[model samples]
Target: MDSDSHPAAAPADDKTWEELVKNVLRAEMMRRGVSYAALAERLAAFGITDNELNLRNKVSRGRFTAVFLMQVLKALEVEWVHVPASIDDAARKGGAQALAASKRQP
Candidate 1:
């Protein structure tokens, strides 16, 4: 997807790295006007089945593997942001805070 077409980058908050990444994917989908079904169809071209694609899109921790993430990025036509390399110290701290918050949630 064209960088110009993407939504304005939001400031990273107290959200886990995974949550932040998932939010980015959701935001990109909205910006592209692509439905989950359409994304699944595109992933099918990469041999990712509907059920598997659906699970991946759900953003459950264990459900999202590295390969799955790569496929999702490819299907979404979004620039792949490498987590470890791209996340700054502030982002990492925010993610840690988010993780702590989730653990405290009842």
Candidate 2:
């Protein structure tokens, strides 16, 4: 039987993954003082257009493709750290809740 075909192991919350990746990318960019424009230019050299970068930046939740994450990591010149599945889940849930709260008007 196919592993994914089983009902017990559904997909992990994607919103969490997107949020976590976004946070990590943002933090790394900030730490290196790399502006979006600068990153855009660098990515452009690699044939990753500004529009694509913007879309990646806008992803709020979902499974982050390894290729996409690696591209960003390469642009940032950072090593990848493996995060536990539980941590990713928590981060995604927390990020989603925070985003929802921030969108609410007073």
**Alpha carbon lDDT of each predicted model:** 0.57, 0.58
All candidates: CA RMSD (Å)? 12.0, 9.6
Residues 5-103, candidate 1: write the lDDT tens digits. 865445565355555566545555655677777888888889988764555547534236678777877888877443332344314434533332332
TM-score of each: 0.52, 0.54
Index of the highest-TM-score prediction: 2
How big is the positional error of residue 53 in model 2, measured in Å on the Cα after superposition? Answer: 7.3
Kindly provide the TM-score of model 1 when superposed on the true structure, using C-alpha atoms: 0.52
Instruction: State which candidate has the highest lDDT.
Output: 2
* Residue pairs with backbone overlap in model 1: none
Q: Candidate 1: minimum summed lDDT over ten consecutive residues — where? A: 97-106
